[model samples]
Target: MTDETLHLRRLRSPIGRIEVVGDGRAVTSLAIERDGMLPHDGEDESGDPVLDRAVAQLEEYFAGTRHDFDVPVDLHGTAFQRAVWEQIVQLQWGEVVSYGDLGQATGRATAGRAVGGAVGANPVPIIVPCHRVLGADGRITGYSGGEGIPTKSWLLEHEGVPHTVPASARPRATDVTAAELDLPADAPAA
Candidate 1:
Protein backbone atom coordinates (compact mmCIF):
# COMPACT_ATOMS: atom_id res chain seq x y z
CA MET A 1 0.00 0.00 0.00
CA THR A 2 1.01 3.61 -0.48
CA ASP A 3 0.34 4.45 3.17
CA GLU A 4 -1.93 7.27 2.07
CA THR A 5 -3.90 9.14 4.71
CA LEU A 6 -6.74 11.63 4.33
CA HIS A 7 -6.45 15.21 5.55
CA LEU A 8 -9.28 17.65 6.20
CA ARG A 9 -10.15 21.23 7.06
CA ARG A 10 -13.24 23.28 7.81
CA LEU A 11 -13.88 26.77 6.48
CA ARG A 12 -16.54 29.33 7.25
CA SER A 13 -17.45 31.67 4.43
CA PRO A 14 -20.13 34.21 3.61
CA ILE A 15 -21.75 31.67 1.33
CA GLY A 16 -21.98 29.40 4.40
CA ARG A 17 -19.66 26.68 5.76
CA ILE A 18 -17.54 24.19 3.87
CA GLU A 19 -15.50 21.09 4.63
CA VAL A 20 -12.42 20.11 2.63
CA VAL A 21 -10.77 16.69 2.49
CA GLY A 22 -7.33 16.13 1.05
CA ASP A 23 -4.82 13.40 0.50
CA GLY A 24 -1.78 15.21 1.95
CA ARG A 25 -0.62 16.69 -1.35
CA ALA A 26 -3.87 17.62 -3.13
CA VAL A 27 -7.45 18.33 -2.21
CA THR A 28 -9.73 15.40 -2.81
CA SER A 29 -13.02 16.78 -1.65
CA LEU A 30 -14.71 20.09 -0.95
CA ALA A 31 -18.16 19.89 0.55
CA ILE A 32 -20.51 22.66 1.54
CA GLU A 33 -21.90 22.33 5.04
CA ARG A 34 -25.54 21.69 5.61
CA ASP A 35 -27.38 21.68 8.91
CA GLY A 36 -26.58 18.03 9.56
CA MET A 37 -22.91 18.16 8.63
CA LEU A 38 -21.32 17.67 11.99
CA PRO A 39 -17.64 17.27 12.62
CA HIS A 40 -16.41 13.74 12.18
CA ASP A 41 -13.91 12.26 14.56
CA GLY A 42 -11.42 9.52 13.73
CA GLU A 43 -7.92 10.48 12.74
CA ASP A 44 -8.65 14.20 12.76
CA GLU A 45 -5.80 15.04 10.44
CA SER A 46 -7.08 18.62 10.35
CA GLY A 47 -3.73 20.05 11.34
CA ASP A 48 -1.62 18.27 8.79
CA PRO A 49 0.63 20.49 6.66
CA VAL A 50 -0.86 19.17 3.43
CA LEU A 51 -4.40 19.81 4.62
CA ASP A 52 -3.41 23.25 5.85
CA ARG A 53 -1.97 24.05 2.47
CA ALA A 54 -5.17 22.95 0.76
CA VAL A 55 -7.18 25.18 3.08
CA ALA A 56 -4.96 28.13 2.28
CA GLN A 57 -5.44 27.51 -1.41
CA LEU A 58 -9.18 27.32 -0.93
CA GLU A 59 -9.12 30.59 0.93
CA GLU A 60 -7.34 32.12 -2.00
CA TYR A 61 -9.97 30.73 -4.33
CA PHE A 62 -12.78 32.20 -2.27
CA ALA A 63 -10.97 35.51 -2.33
CA GLY A 64 -11.08 35.35 -6.15
CA THR A 65 -7.32 35.25 -6.43
CA ARG A 66 -7.31 31.77 -7.87
CA HIS A 67 -9.23 30.19 -10.73
CA ASP A 68 -7.51 26.83 -11.12
CA PHE A 69 -6.62 24.30 -8.49
CA ASP A 70 -3.15 22.72 -8.70
CA VAL A 71 -3.40 19.89 -6.22
CA PRO A 72 -3.35 16.15 -6.92
CA VAL A 73 -6.91 15.20 -6.08
CA ASP A 74 -7.56 11.52 -5.55
CA LEU A 75 -11.10 11.31 -6.88
CA HIS A 76 -13.01 8.21 -5.83
CA GLY A 77 -15.91 6.81 -7.84
CA THR A 78 -16.95 5.21 -11.11
CA ALA A 79 -15.58 6.08 -14.55
CA PHE A 80 -18.77 7.94 -15.40
CA GLN A 81 -18.47 9.92 -12.22
CA ARG A 82 -14.88 10.83 -13.00
CA ALA A 83 -15.88 11.91 -16.49
CA VAL A 84 -18.62 14.15 -15.16
CA TRP A 85 -16.35 15.80 -12.59
CA GLU A 86 -13.61 16.31 -15.15
CA GLN A 87 -16.04 18.11 -17.44
CA ILE A 88 -17.09 20.34 -14.57
CA VAL A 89 -13.51 21.47 -14.10
CA GLN A 90 -13.59 22.73 -17.67
CA LEU A 91 -16.48 25.11 -17.04
CA GLN A 92 -15.75 28.77 -17.62
CA TRP A 93 -15.34 30.79 -14.45
CA GLY A 94 -18.44 32.93 -14.89
CA GLU A 95 -20.40 30.71 -17.20
CA VAL A 96 -23.21 28.29 -16.40
CA VAL A 97 -24.09 25.11 -18.27
CA SER A 98 -27.26 23.08 -18.06
CA TYR A 99 -27.29 19.37 -17.30
CA GLY A 100 -28.03 18.66 -20.94
CA ASP A 101 -25.22 20.96 -21.93
CA LEU A 102 -22.86 19.21 -19.58
CA GLY A 103 -23.84 15.92 -21.11
CA GLN A 104 -23.03 17.25 -24.52
CA ALA A 105 -19.76 18.68 -23.30
CA THR A 106 -18.77 15.34 -21.89
CA GLY A 107 -19.67 13.63 -25.19
CA ARG A 108 -22.50 11.86 -23.43
CA ALA A 109 -25.30 13.98 -24.82
CA THR A 110 -27.78 11.18 -24.36
CA ALA A 111 -26.70 10.52 -20.83
CA GLY A 112 -28.19 13.56 -19.16
CA ARG A 113 -29.52 11.51 -16.29
CA ALA A 114 -26.19 9.86 -15.74
CA VAL A 115 -24.54 13.27 -15.86
CA GLY A 116 -26.86 14.53 -13.15
CA GLY A 117 -26.07 11.51 -11.05
CA ALA A 118 -22.37 12.07 -11.48
CA VAL A 119 -22.68 15.74 -10.55
CA GLY A 120 -24.61 14.85 -7.44
CA ALA A 121 -21.79 12.58 -6.42
CA ASN A 122 -19.04 15.11 -7.06
CA PRO A 123 -16.48 14.81 -4.25
CA VAL A 124 -14.95 18.21 -4.77
CA PRO A 125 -17.64 20.87 -4.73
CA ILE A 126 -16.57 24.44 -5.45
CA ILE A 127 -13.11 23.64 -6.73
CA VAL A 128 -14.68 21.31 -9.26
CA PRO A 129 -17.31 23.90 -10.21
CA CYS A 130 -20.22 21.53 -9.68
CA HIS A 131 -22.19 24.61 -8.81
CA ARG A 132 -21.91 25.75 -12.41
CA VAL A 133 -24.28 23.09 -13.60
CA LEU A 134 -27.95 24.00 -13.90
CA GLY A 135 -31.35 22.81 -15.05
CA ALA A 136 -32.22 22.68 -18.72
CA ASP A 137 -34.55 25.63 -18.33
CA GLY A 138 -31.78 27.67 -16.73
CA ARG A 139 -33.06 27.13 -13.21
CA ILE A 140 -30.84 26.23 -10.31
CA THR A 141 -30.97 22.58 -9.40
CA GLY A 142 -29.07 20.60 -6.77
CA TYR A 143 -25.87 21.42 -4.95
CA SER A 144 -23.93 19.34 -2.46
CA GLY A 145 -23.65 22.51 -0.41
CA GLY A 146 -26.53 21.25 1.74
CA GLU A 147 -28.70 24.19 0.70
CA GLY A 148 -29.25 22.27 -2.51
CA ILE A 149 -30.80 24.58 -5.09
CA PRO A 150 -30.06 27.62 -2.96
CA THR A 151 -26.40 26.78 -2.82
CA LYS A 152 -26.39 26.62 -6.59
CA SER A 153 -27.95 30.03 -6.64
CA TRP A 154 -25.31 31.38 -4.32
CA LEU A 155 -22.47 29.99 -6.36
CA LEU A 156 -23.93 31.33 -9.59
CA GLU A 157 -24.24 34.75 -8.06
CA HIS A 158 -20.70 34.56 -6.74
CA GLU A 159 -19.45 33.82 -10.22
CA GLY A 160 -21.44 36.68 -11.73
CA VAL A 161 -23.66 34.31 -13.65
CA PRO A 162 -27.09 35.83 -14.26
CA HIS A 163 -29.85 33.79 -12.67
CA THR A 164 -33.49 34.29 -11.84
CA VAL A 165 -34.57 34.35 -8.21
CA PRO A 166 -36.96 36.20 -5.94
CA ALA A 167 -35.52 39.46 -4.72
CA SER A 168 -35.42 38.15 -1.18
CA ALA A 169 -33.63 35.05 -2.40
CA ARG A 170 -30.60 36.89 -3.70
CA PRO A 171 -27.29 35.61 -2.40
CA ARG A 172 -25.92 37.46 0.59
CA ALA A 173 -22.37 36.64 -0.42
CA THR A 174 -22.84 39.08 -3.28
CA ASP A 175 -22.42 41.96 -0.89
CA VAL A 176 -18.70 41.42 -1.02
CA THR A 177 -16.81 41.95 -4.26
CA ALA A 178 -14.12 39.58 -5.47
CA ALA A 179 -11.56 42.07 -4.21
CA GLU A 180 -13.27 42.42 -0.86
CA LEU A 181 -13.33 38.67 -0.63
CA ASP A 182 -9.64 38.77 -1.62
CA LEU A 183 -10.34 36.80 -4.80
CA PRO A 184 -8.91 37.87 -8.16
CA ALA A 185 -11.77 36.80 -10.44
CA ASP A 186 -9.19 36.01 -13.11
CA ALA A 187 -6.90 33.37 -11.63
CA PRO A 188 -5.96 31.39 -8.56
CA ALA A 189 -3.71 32.84 -5.88
CA ALA A 190 -2.28 29.43 -5.22
Candidate 2:
Protein backbone atom coordinates (compact mmCIF):
# COMPACT_ATOMS: atom_id res chain seq x y z
CA MET A 1 0.00 0.00 0.00
CA THR A 2 1.23 3.46 -0.83
CA ASP A 3 1.56 5.73 2.18
CA GLU A 4 -0.14 9.08 1.99
CA THR A 5 2.28 11.80 2.96
CA LEU A 6 1.25 14.83 4.99
CA HIS A 7 2.82 18.05 3.81
CA LEU A 8 3.18 21.19 5.90
CA ARG A 9 4.03 24.88 5.61
CA ARG A 10 4.50 27.86 7.88
CA LEU A 11 3.14 31.36 7.41
CA ARG A 12 3.21 34.58 9.39
CA SER A 13 -0.05 36.41 10.05
CA PRO A 14 -1.06 39.62 11.79
CA ILE A 15 -1.94 37.57 14.83
CA GLY A 16 1.10 35.33 15.02
CA ARG A 17 2.76 32.41 13.19
CA ILE A 18 0.69 29.63 11.69
CA GLU A 19 1.46 26.05 10.69
CA VAL A 20 -0.61 24.56 7.88
CA VAL A 21 -0.74 20.89 6.90
CA GLY A 22 -2.11 19.22 3.83
CA ASP A 23 -2.32 15.90 2.00
CA GLY A 24 -1.36 17.26 -1.46
CA ARG A 25 -4.91 18.06 -2.60
CA ALA A 26 -6.54 19.45 0.53
CA VAL A 27 -5.69 21.01 3.87
CA THR A 28 -5.65 18.50 6.75
CA SER A 29 -4.97 20.89 9.60
CA LEU A 30 -4.09 24.50 10.40
CA ALA A 31 -2.76 25.73 13.71
CA ILE A 32 -1.65 29.06 15.23
CA GLU A 33 1.41 28.88 17.42
CA ARG A 34 4.21 31.17 18.55
CA ASP A 35 6.81 32.75 16.27
CA GLY A 36 9.36 29.94 16.63
CA MET A 37 6.85 27.12 16.56
CA LEU A 38 7.74 23.86 14.80
CA PRO A 39 5.56 21.48 12.84
CA HIS A 40 3.96 18.49 14.49
CA ASP A 41 6.27 15.62 15.46
CA GLY A 42 7.96 14.31 12.28
CA GLU A 43 5.32 15.78 10.00
CA ASP A 44 7.23 18.34 8.03
CA GLU A 45 7.07 17.85 4.27
CA SER A 46 6.86 21.57 3.50
CA GLY A 47 7.53 21.32 -0.20
CA ASP A 48 3.99 20.61 -1.33
CA PRO A 49 1.48 22.52 -3.42
CA VAL A 50 -1.44 22.15 -1.04
CA LEU A 51 0.55 23.70 1.75
CA ASP A 52 1.63 26.53 -0.49
CA ARG A 53 -1.96 27.36 -1.30
CA ALA A 54 -2.96 27.28 2.34
CA VAL A 55 -0.22 29.71 3.19
CA ALA A 56 -1.33 32.02 0.40
CA GLN A 57 -4.91 31.92 1.59
CA LEU A 58 -3.79 32.69 5.12
CA GLU A 59 -1.89 35.68 3.85
CA GLU A 60 -5.03 36.97 2.22
CA TYR A 61 -7.00 36.44 5.41
CA PHE A 62 -4.53 38.41 7.49
CA ALA A 63 -4.60 41.24 4.98
CA GLY A 64 -8.30 41.69 5.80
CA THR A 65 -9.52 41.14 2.28
CA ARG A 66 -10.63 37.53 2.52
CA HIS A 67 -13.41 36.13 4.66
CA ASP A 68 -13.54 32.52 3.62
CA PHE A 69 -11.02 29.85 2.68
CA ASP A 70 -11.56 28.19 -0.68
CA VAL A 71 -9.03 25.38 -0.51
CA PRO A 72 -10.31 21.82 -0.09
CA VAL A 73 -10.03 20.39 3.43
CA ASP A 74 -9.54 16.80 4.59
CA LEU A 75 -10.67 16.87 8.19
CA HIS A 76 -10.01 13.78 10.34
CA GLY A 77 -12.18 13.25 13.37
CA THR A 78 -14.97 11.19 14.89
CA ALA A 79 -18.52 11.72 13.62
CA PHE A 80 -19.44 13.80 16.61
CA GLN A 81 -16.36 15.93 16.40
CA ARG A 82 -16.87 16.43 12.69
CA ALA A 83 -20.43 17.53 13.40
CA VAL A 84 -19.22 20.05 15.93
CA TRP A 85 -16.60 21.45 13.60
CA GLU A 86 -19.12 21.60 10.79
CA GLN A 87 -21.40 23.68 12.96
CA ILE A 88 -18.49 25.95 13.75
CA VAL A 89 -18.21 26.99 10.13
CA GLN A 90 -21.65 28.54 10.34
CA LEU A 91 -20.63 31.28 12.76
CA GLN A 92 -21.01 34.77 11.31
CA TRP A 93 -17.96 37.03 11.19
CA GLY A 94 -18.87 39.32 14.08
CA GLU A 95 -20.93 36.88 16.10
CA VAL A 96 -20.17 34.55 18.98
CA VAL A 97 -21.84 31.31 20.00
CA SER A 98 -21.69 29.49 23.28
CA TYR A 99 -20.59 25.84 23.45
CA GLY A 100 -23.95 24.79 24.83
CA ASP A 101 -25.68 26.61 22.00
CA LEU A 102 -23.47 24.88 19.47
CA GLY A 103 -24.29 21.49 20.97
CA GLN A 104 -27.97 22.27 20.71
CA ALA A 105 -27.54 23.53 17.18
CA THR A 106 -25.99 20.18 16.30
CA GLY A 107 -28.90 18.30 17.90
CA ARG A 108 -26.62 17.13 20.67
CA ALA A 109 -27.89 19.30 23.47
CA THR A 110 -26.35 17.15 26.16
CA ALA A 111 -23.00 17.05 24.46
CA GLY A 112 -21.76 20.54 25.25
CA ARG A 113 -18.61 19.13 26.88
CA ALA A 114 -18.04 16.87 23.90
CA VAL A 115 -18.52 19.85 21.61
CA GLY A 116 -15.96 21.79 23.63
CA GLY A 117 -13.48 18.97 23.17
CA ALA A 118 -14.16 18.98 19.45
CA VAL A 119 -13.66 22.74 19.32
CA GLY A 120 -10.36 22.28 21.15
CA ALA A 121 -9.25 19.84 18.45
CA ASN A 122 -10.42 21.86 15.45
CA PRO A 123 -7.76 21.34 12.78
CA VAL A 124 -8.44 24.68 11.17
CA PRO A 125 -8.73 27.55 13.63
CA ILE A 126 -9.97 30.78 12.05
CA ILE A 127 -11.44 29.15 8.99
CA VAL A 128 -13.49 26.77 11.09
CA PRO A 129 -14.10 29.44 13.73
CA CYS A 130 -13.49 27.60 16.98
CA HIS A 131 -12.56 31.02 18.25
CA ARG A 132 -16.18 32.08 18.03
CA VAL A 133 -17.30 29.56 20.58
CA LEU A 134 -17.66 30.89 24.11
CA GLY A 135 -18.36 29.45 27.55
CA ALA A 136 -21.74 28.84 29.15
CA ASP A 137 -21.62 32.21 30.86
CA GLY A 138 -20.81 33.99 27.61
CA ARG A 139 -17.17 34.34 28.65
CA ILE A 140 -13.99 33.19 26.99
CA THR A 141 -12.97 29.64 27.70
CA GLY A 142 -10.16 27.40 26.59
CA TYR A 143 -8.10 27.93 23.48
CA SER A 144 -5.79 25.30 22.05
CA GLY A 145 -3.35 28.01 21.08
CA GLY A 146 -0.52 28.22 23.63
CA GLU A 147 -1.49 31.70 24.77
CA GLY A 148 -4.81 30.29 26.00
CA ILE A 149 -7.88 32.41 26.90
CA PRO A 150 -6.11 35.63 26.03
CA THR A 151 -5.84 34.49 22.44
CA LYS A 152 -9.55 33.75 22.40
CA SER A 153 -10.34 37.20 23.75
CA TRP A 154 -8.07 38.85 21.23
CA LEU A 155 -9.59 36.94 18.35
CA LEU A 156 -13.10 37.93 19.41
CA GLU A 157 -12.15 41.56 19.69
CA HIS A 158 -10.38 41.49 16.35
CA GLU A 159 -13.51 40.16 14.74
CA GLY A 160 -15.55 43.00 16.29
CA VAL A 161 -17.60 40.57 18.30
CA PRO A 162 -18.75 42.20 21.49
CA HIS A 163 -17.61 40.03 24.37
CA THR A 164 -19.05 40.49 27.82
CA VAL A 165 -15.97 40.19 29.92
CA PRO A 166 -16.31 39.88 33.67
CA ALA A 167 -14.58 42.63 35.65
CA SER A 168 -11.75 40.23 36.52
CA ALA A 169 -11.29 39.37 32.85
CA ARG A 170 -9.97 42.84 32.12
CA PRO A 171 -6.28 43.01 31.32
CA ARG A 172 -3.88 45.71 32.44
CA ALA A 173 -2.48 47.96 29.72
CA THR A 174 1.08 46.69 30.19
CA ASP A 175 0.41 42.97 30.43
CA VAL A 176 2.34 41.71 27.40
CA THR A 177 -0.55 42.27 25.05
CA ALA A 178 -1.63 41.42 21.51
CA ALA A 179 -3.80 44.57 21.55
CA GLU A 180 -1.17 46.46 19.63
CA LEU A 181 -1.75 44.41 16.46
CA ASP A 182 -4.29 46.83 15.03
CA LEU A 183 -3.26 50.25 16.22
CA PRO A 184 -5.79 52.77 17.56
CA ALA A 185 -8.48 50.60 19.12
CA ASP A 186 -11.04 53.20 18.10
CA ALA A 187 -9.98 53.17 14.46
CA PRO A 188 -13.01 51.13 13.33
CA ALA A 189 -13.76 47.54 14.18
CA ALA A 190 -12.81 45.41 11.19
**Candidate 2 residue-pair clash tally:** 0
Predicted structure 1, TM vs. truth: 0.77
Across 1-190, the per-residue lDDT of candidate 2 in tens digits comes to 1235657777554456667777778887777764346456355455487677767666655555556777778778999899888888877777778898888988989987788899999888887888888887777767886356666677677667766665555421212222443233443333
Q: What is the lDDT of candidate 1?
A: 0.69
- Per-residue CA lDDT of candidate 1, range 32-126, in tens? 75664634434354546766766677677666666666666778899878988887888877877789987887788999779989999988787
Question: Would you give me the overall lDDT of model 2?
Answer: 0.70
Consecutive 10-residue window with the lowest summed lDDT within model 1: 168-177
TM-score of each candidate structure, all chains considered together: 0.77, 0.77
As a whole number from 0 to 100, the lDDT of residue 67 in candidate 1 is 62
Candidate 1 regions exceeding 4 Å error are: 1-4, 39-45, 166-190
